[model samples]
Target: MDWNRTKSIFIVVFLILNIFLYSLYVNRYNEAQSVEVAGEKTIDARLKEDNITYGVLPNSVESATYISGKVHTFTAADFTDPNHQANITDPKEARVILLSPVKLRNVNDDASFTEFVQANIKEGGSYGLWKVNRDERIAIFFQKTNNRMLYYNKSGLLKIQWNADNEVTMYEQTMLDNIEEVEQQESALPPIQVIQALYAKGLLKPDSRIEHMQLGYSTLVYLTQTQVLLPTWEVRVKLSDGEIEEYFVDAVEGKIIEIQEEKQEVEEEDWGV
Candidate 1:
């Protein structure tokens, strides 16, 4: 047997096997890297995708019907901060968000807060404010549409807050977001009709004096999970004994709506004469 020749042949075979193994390893490693890169596309590459093209959704009549008025644009790019971030979510859904003393000027309690809000919003400005509930320090104003007036906390409408000094300290608003302008603005019942409906419900007394009558949006259902705001007429009634009562009537249907009412306790008298 030729030992040197056999040894040389064995060495060559081993070298060939090592080269084949290395090639296989390199191919598998390359395949793994390729799969990882393909998992998530880069921003530029994603923009080029057939479905994505851009960030905005395509225009459709159905989509437009859900949104109202012109596309409102208000962004506080300067308000962006890591320490004191804004409490705004879903820019598409949140139309108006204003922080006090930030981009806000000339705010006062003497209806100035309401005035400032009216100036900010182009459509459905509050012509006559409907006074709802207020203490010595705070005053709230509601905007009136063609049909009825709406309050701040009622239907996610504009909420303006002014301090006792008559300067608008702060205000929170969520209008123009997902707005759907309908052709029918004059759909609600008038204030007089709303008052008659309240009388029909036995809520108003013969001597009940109407202190204030204003239109606003009422919360049909305001819950942590969901919310609904409907057009309503708010009437402040004062009885003969000097007691105040608040009544809400549906603006569209002219029906009385009672959310929560307090129970009255009367003293019983014994007739044991």
Candidate 2:
């Protein structure tokens, strides 16, 4: 065997592997820090100026709000008592407002989150959940509200992390609340009524791999349909023991909308290059 030739090939392969790993590392790192919107680059930066920390991000407002073509705003608020008469050793309070790169409406608490999630499910869009504390939780559905972003957690119970394409992720508590709503609603609908509805619509076709369907804001079910594979436009349906269930139906038009699939379909583009 040619020892030198074998050694050279191993070195080349090792270098290529390292380069591939490095590229992946760089791409994931970039996605974690920045979100791209409307052909603009936006990043979250924390700066201490004059002993105050401010979060720097691109100006999302329409009116050319940045003085130097960039915007620096307060991300968290100070809770120092303005009425204090003397300096004390108590821990200073902090009020943090989570921001989304996508413009979203602010919901005050968990109840509002539930309402918003229900509305979005009815309208056919994706929803996110927020957990302010261990027991405090909220769910937000996209496209149901006018604002594309949502901010919550003044007391630090919620944390918002934005990905490269304005995708928002929250803790498990929030996801559970959102999923639970759909399950509960479907349980209340009569099974015989559900099967009859499918039969009337000519949806119970043989040899079809029926997936789950989404109903108005609260229920998702599986059903037998003529179409073996579900298109993105169809409501999520599932069929089990001849019972049909629906999820994420458009309240107005009865159209199915898959918000998560839509977000994942965006093409990867060079950012900050």
Q: Find the candidate with the highest lDDT and give its number.
A: 1
117-217 per-residue lDDT for model 2 (tens digits): 34322222334342322223223232211222111211111223233343332211111111111111112222223323443355544423235332222
Candidate 1 — which residues are off by over 4 angstroms?
A: 1-86, 89-109, 119-128, 132-136, 151-155, 160-166, 178-193, 214-231, 260-273
lDDT of each: 0.47, 0.29
Best by TM-score: 1
Q: Please list the Cα RMSD from the true structure of every candidate, rounded to 1 decimal place.
A: 25.3, 25.4
Per-residue lDDT for 115-216 in model 1, tens only?
Answer: 555665334363344442345333344434444443433333443444555544444333333334443444556554555576556676655567776555
Q: Model 1 clash pairs? A: 68-179, 107-167, 107-168, 108-166, 108-167, 108-168, 109-166, 109-167, 149-215, 149-216
Which segments of candidate 2 are over 4 A away from where they belong?
A: 1-161, 165-189, 209-235, 238-273
**Backbone clashes, candidate 2:** 29
